[model samples]
Target: MWIAESVTFGGSALDRAAPLRGDAPALADLQARGRIVPLWQGKPLIANGALAWVAPGSPVLAEATAPVFLGLEDGIGWFAQDISAWVPPEAEAVQPGFLDPSLQHHPSLPADHTFTELRAVMAQLSPRHAELAATARALLGWHQSHGFCAACGAASTMVMAGWQRSCPVCGAQHYPRTDPVVIMLVTRGNRLLLGRGTGWPEGMYSCLAGFVEPGETIEAAVRREVFEETGVQVDAVRYLASQPWPFPASLMLGCLAEATSDTITLDPAELEDALWLSREDLVQVRTGLHPCVKPARQGAIAHFLIENWLADRLN
Candidate 1:
């Protein structure tokens, strides 16, 4: 299929400036002049259908800030503030926050807003906002989950501008973890294969995917996932694209595999159903006329692959 050069969070203009993450003095200065994006329990601040970035002088930054130093953009530093402790009484928690932030008190702020979901607003956000939000969410999630050292069971402190966690007692340095997942667009002649899990909404089918094994290559992962889930043999697998899916941190490896067998043996434990659809069937589905399958949502690599397959753009 066609390679998507610009996945949701892949194409961005921010200069990460990895070396500067270790500069404490520089980081502090950045916090003073840089803009702040509040993440309530890891959900980015959203307003007017986009991410809400707070200025350095904003009351929220000065009063309730627990800022995690994000990278720079256009030479201007950026940070994300964890304000989960200050959620309003009547407001409900959003669906996609990375993990719980232990907040003590509510801060003075406006009564209402549009939304606070990162995935929900990703497609509508600017590339800058999307990249920053994804970075903040993944970084904060790592800190929340890795607060203690695995080696010596010691508490770890945040370091490297929220990029690394260091254990105080063990002196162990830990970095953020990202899981790799192989998402395949398997095709046989003019048809493509799609699978739906047990709990998914009815008629919603997308690419077959599974996590990468310890010793397996991306190509091996693609073939293994397809057979394990659907019992369909595959060959001629080639990589297409990659996407960073930060719902608790996963790197999606998108690939295209040509199925050698037309018959499918369904694995009920792994998939509720798996089937082949022709190019015409995809056209109907994309146009909202197909009855058996609903197209994948926008901004997802699955959607990107399917759209490209229909247009014969998989070069």
Candidate 2:
């Protein structure tokens, strides 16, 4: 796991600048000279295969919500603003699917610069840009969903540079929440356990994954998820790498586990199908030559784990 940090969305060494979160003067100064990443409906604006940054007073940001201070690099500040309120002249109806392939364009931005889904271009972005996009998406999504205080029914106000929300009625402060999920690469000798959820694309299968329940350790979560999903008993679970999955804010904890039992008793509610693939079969899947299985998403931790396992780098 020496190369663990190299996983997508995990390796940007961006300086978060925690202390400056509460300093109004400092943040104001940074905002005046910083670059901003505009997001629409959770999609970051992209141009030339990278994050397209705009100035603070860009016309595209006229309808933007409060900006979140992302951090600084090379003495220049980076921020993210949500312009989800702006309606496109001819907005495409929102598609009901896992990943939205539609792109949005603001009149102020160049024609080449479009608001794109992060998953569609995550692999193409540099480490720094990927990290920034993930952070902004997750934080903004949290704000949208958690507008009301949990402790009280009163609405909350953004504070701490978009990192926290304060409830005036109850004097309660809430921070962005990230749920932990364990995605395991369960192996028995030369075969790996794979499962396909309901509604997944045909021929698509990936490492079994589930959320870490309350009071459960990472090891326990891995074992439980594998057993619950496929009736496979796992032992000797070890940490692999992690990915920040921001579909709605999840920290995917990747793990490698040895399967003691190969029998699959599928939970109809959890998975549509479960099976094991030998290393040779997996190789074919990765290369798009397998008849029954498609490769995992390229920028996902499942793909990272499988690629490393194929190369015998899972030590």
Candidate 3:
């Protein structure tokens, strides 16, 4: 909680410049000196541990069709484009993966440039890069998924500089929506509760999380999720930090809670297993000495909470 803003995808604030998003003339003027960040297949170009954030008139922007205005910084406009639809030129065939030794160049940019998955290189990026990448992914993914108006089933047009979609026939407007998920750090005495989803990687465990239902509060959601996932009743829920998890769109509301009772009830449909890990157990996992139950990976709120708990920083 003390290091709340240090969480990967939530704390960093990207100036959206919402009003300017609707100003075509102002946007165009800014475009003359603005920078564009292109996303291909949900990944961004990373050169020397930074986003390309190409300047106006770059080859990348020239090839991009109808980019979304991201926001502004220092009077310079920022925009984003999803070029996943663009077909790449021919290249030497190789295995497709980050592990492949050879570099994969951008289809439009120079041969030295390459695109990498944000998650794979997020830790290497600055706080701003992570924030912008999350913003772009969420906005673009929303556009990709919501192509029609839910109210009238009419085709929608991108408007508000990518902040909204409008259906001309119905006069309906749709904005990007983020689903709220409650992730709790439930503790009883010196032990913390962690659960592994049914399909999670072996040895991987994290805090209990579930989407907040309609008409539910964050505190209630945390209590309900912890109880439903592991049959552990918790009370006195307190907010911690949050993260923007845009693997299609989610806002993780991290919280800390006090368990009223310790009881294990496996929701087979929700979790593969649930267990209580003490500080020593967590230390072993952190040290890679535990036989199973690896700590949540860095950059995740679960890991952030656990690390802070270990350091007596969570308040």
**TM agreement with the true structure for every prediction:** 0.90, 0.98, 0.91
Candidate 2 regions exceeding 4 Å error are none
Candidate RMSDs in Å, in order, are 3.5, 0.9, 2.7
What lDDT tens digits, residue by residue, belong to model 2 across residues 1-315? Answer: 988989989899999998999999999999999999999999999998898899989999999999999999998889999999998767653456878888888888899999998999999999999999999999999999999999987999999999999999999999999999999999999999999999998998999999999999999999998988888999999998899999989999999999999999999999999999999999899889999999999889999999999999977
Winner on TM-score (2 vs 3): 2
Residues 85-157, model 3: lDDT tens digits: 6555556323464233333466567765676667666766778778888888889889988999999999999
Scored by Cα lDDT, where does model 3 land? 0.82
Greater lDDT among 1 and 2 belongs to 2
| lDDT per model vs. reference | 0.80, 0.93, 0.82
Best by TM-score: 2
lDDT of 2 at 111: 95
Summing lDDT over every window of 10 consecutive residues in candidate 1, give the lowest-scoring window. Answer: 96-105
What lDDT tens digits, residue by residue, belong to model 1 across residues 18-134? 898889899888888888887766677776767677777665554343567778877788888766556555545443233233222234444343336676667887777788888
